[model samples]
Target: MPHTGHHLRAVFRRPDFRRLLSARLTFQGADGVFQAGLTGTILFNPDRQTSAMAIALGFAVLLLPYSLIGPFAGVLLDRWSRRNVLIIANIVRAAVVPAVAAMIWVGIAAEAFLPLVLIVVGGTRLVSAAVSAALPHVVDEKELVTANSFISTAGGLAYAVGIAAAMGLRPLFGASDHGYAIIALMSVLGYVGTALVIRKFTPNELGPDDVPDSGGVSVARLAWHELRTGAQHLAARKNAAGALLVVVGMRVFFGAALIAVVLLYRNYFTADGFFRTHETGLGQIMFASAAGNLIAAGITPAATRLFGTRQWLGMLLPLAAAAQLGLGILFTMPGLIAASFLVAIASQGARLVAETTLQTECADEYRGRVFSVFDTLFNACLVLGLVAGAAFLPETGKSYAALIVISVGYGLLAAGYLWLSRGSTLPVMPAKPKTEPAQALTQLR
Candidate 1:
């Protein structure tokens, strides 16, 4: 491990990793800005109902298509030039965002918010899945963990900074329509930047070429094969399965908890309360959570080393549940705001790093589809969270009891599952060579 660490450092000393890392930062920086600003943009219209609906729809737009398309995306990724897929995906997203912003700006279709948001969301997810699936092709096996860590850190920070920047820019746009337009423009710029960097990459940077099944393959047959291949790879390894299971379960648990957060926030701050009058307070809460996520990303590499990935993630499950419970308790208590935020940041940040690292450790051939499966699970949980949160929060009249029951229950179940599976055999880490900056950028271009 120490020798690998030395090689990791030595590899980065070469310019390729530096450039690849820089491109990652640029792309994710744009992502952070977009995500942070999106909620604010939706809320700018002052129709709380519409804004809330937009938020709901925005999430749906992104998650549903990602889930549905995710199964096939991996197969396509294996068959296509990862770089081309990535570049095209981002460019498509760049184009879509502007169109949506225009419709909203003209007010001709601003009211038809659901369809518009979905178009943008679905498009972005398709692109994102392609990029994620292709990531292993860009970094070395020894440095894969470090690269994954760096990416997760960049992503979380982008989430925080982007949201913060968006909030700050709120006054300039005045309306979410314009704000989203700018964000879309940023997306365009980011994608262009990414495409330029990706153009530098060569085919050698990627995993071994995938030979399509020789047997006459139908669309259904291909999807089934891809899905089963990913599953079989996972099933072959016990520790990897345990790791994957905990992470997937965490996604389901988080879906419910995040829904509770929206409910609590809307009830306590946005809907009506002493806190309701402060406009950006709700935004600040999101900012705080992202901040926590960023912090976790920073420390995750260290944490994974400190706690065995299996044991630590196993334990974090219960701790995260407890954190959610804390969030549920603190939802209405204005005085304990900082404590609530702390818990949230720690829980989410820790989990994000832990899960991503686990997925990256899986086999190279399976990595794309493995991640796709995880993406499917994550998106599925998100959809379920939206429905459950909407149903539970509004109908339950902000029932803390229900929130506690769901959050803690899932946490315990995940923790127990991990504990029992702790002794299981772990998988050998997969091998993948890092792409040169020139090669990664060029192959895709």
Candidate 2:
């Protein structure tokens, strides 16, 4: 059974993929819609700058707690059933949404933004971490690329739809007290759907590592051992380390660059400028990026095959760096907007394929902890970038010289990763249980 293009298409047609896709799209889309409403409602209010900052502070507060706890959650995922975790996580989200809604309705949102948003953001990130870490347990490694591609496509759809809906619903709802409530309802529905679909999914049973450590080891000692073990496992794998470094470094630059883009957009376009007039420019950009994601999803299998290991990673990293550079240069050019959009598509598409493939290669027992490490570092770098970018915020007119300089730094790092790993083979993990059909089918049965 070789994976011809016909076979690939049939792979996409699998019932599991469809259900998972639905769950991803719904969860991501609901997130998008909710954020849209939240940001739209807050930004539209003239007296909310301080409140907005408070909300941001809430995000910062949640960041460390979320990141620090993720690895342990991953350990739990390894030991416990992923299906149950996903279902429970969604239920938790559903419960939180209405609480947020109530706060908004009572005019306490601006006052209690910190605590409320902290709980929401932290909880959401933890759930997402658990679900993502658990993906390899559901799909076979042979199907990893295909499964992740579908996930990225669904994410793209969610991003585009969420932005558009947010923009449209703002005017419809008048960005009033009820706006947040509507978003909460959407989140509730999405969570419910996610929980339902998860119920139908049969996850791979936990291996011995998934069992809770009960040999009289204290929780603190277990946590320390798990962290150390996870780190050792990842560090020992040269290929995984290389891929992780590239992603981690790129996220640092990307996080800063993203914040820079936001500031630049606010300065250059604002709600009163191009976006307010057309209203669709943001969506256009998002849709263009989504199109790129879709294209990436379609071509990823072939690209992964043709590019192999080093070449594929090489091409994507530099391509992403170049895209960021292009964005820096064309930050304000309306004509270059489409190019900018495509650049985002290319970067995100490539990263999704490359990163997930790398993560899926790790052993399942260590997978959660390893992924949590990636998530923690990636997120920490992002926050660092945002903070750094804020320092570089232009006080005057439109000048992207600073961004151009930063992009160059990122480009060099990307090139360095390629150079460092030059002699390496594709590093494709050939030890998957599926390769042993007798064992694989036995597990399936």
Candidate 3:
């Protein structure tokens, strides 16, 4: 077997894979910048008084549209040219973001603000679906795990870089609405960059391979039928289904933890010693999570090869539970940061496994719908978790009860996943005959 470095090099050697990855990195980085700008405007603005419920509501406003349109978007992905979808989606985002920035600049965020933001976010979700659907087309089947790990982790790091850029530039841009508006505009460059990079692919190069016949059905009705078919396909694949369920469960708990952390920084913690303002503290946590994601990219490929995908995922859930418990009990900045790191590793590792499982198990025609379902459940459940946590949490966001419940939920989820997967065959990589180092490297190339 080749080393992890060899696997990554092999994946990146493909020109199409590089192009797709470049697009992903660019758009996701833009997403980070846009998201940070919003965070500054809404959550961290000194003039604004933020609460747990308000935060929950904000999440709902941003995420629910994706849930609503995700399935329909999935159907379009399967039928339409995915490359064009990527290009058009980014163009739409480039157009909509300026509208959002204008709304922010005018300080009128009630009527059209949420709607415009929703449009931008929904477009991002579509781009994400198209990218995920297109991934298998650019890489070989055996390299899926490595390809996914690299793209996912690198994209995340790119997002972190965007956030860091926004944070650093905020002072120059001014921390006021005007500054945030400029920051929001910065994302347009990334959106445009993504479109340009993705244009390198032929119209149908990244594809559904075999498009579903609509049979004179209207798009609305065809979407409904296709969604059902996609759901059935996922349900039939027990491993993929189980992996997705685990990812959803993890997202729910992670969402609650995230909300709590935000509140802790914004309301409870104060600037003293190394601790800074809410924005700075939150930035630290975000960077910590990004660091963990980078680590997961390095570790997961080998971990899954050694332990099998299901078992590795099972192991990660408990680590997440432990991380949650550590933060809940300690309730300090250092604890929060440390917990963020550990939880990201666990969460990202599980996501890598789940994505690979879906790509491996589902046919190309169904992959788009399947990934869209994955996106919908992932975001919807995160919002659901945030809302539920808000209902129970105090203004201080220091609800030990909420944290404990989330930690326990992780444990139960892990146990359930392991039991359900007990009788199933694990997707373990088979060992290859040992070769000279040069030969192994040559094979990877």
Query: Among these predicted structures, which one has the highest TM-score?
Result: 3
Error of 1 at 202 (Å): 2.6
lDDT of 1 by residue, 110-146 (tens): 4455465555455455555555555555555556555
Backbone clashes for every candidate come to 24, 2, 0
Clashing pairs in 2: 78-210, 79-210
The candidate, 1 or 2, that scores higher on TM-score is: 2
User: Model 2: per-residue lDDT, tens digit, 1-445?
Assistant: 1443543465566677666667777777767776665554454444344322333343455576667777776666666776777778878878877877776655564546545655556655655556566555556667665666667677668857866777777666655667655764566787788889878876553232346555998766786788898888766666557766676676666656655554444345645355431235545556766777777666655655665555666666666656666654665545336555655554665566555654455566766676666777777766766566655656322446666766676678667867877776553322222453212100000
- Per-candidate Cα RMSD to the true structure, in Å, reads 6.1, 4.9, 4.6
- How high is each candidate's TM-score? 0.81, 0.85, 0.95
Question: Lowest lDDT 10-mer window, candidate 3?
Answer: 436-445
lDDT of each: 0.56, 0.60, 0.83
**Alpha-carbon runs more than 4 Å astray in model 2:** 1-7, 50-59, 109-111, 202-212, 270-281, 333-336, 395-397, 427-445
lDDT of 3 at 112: 56
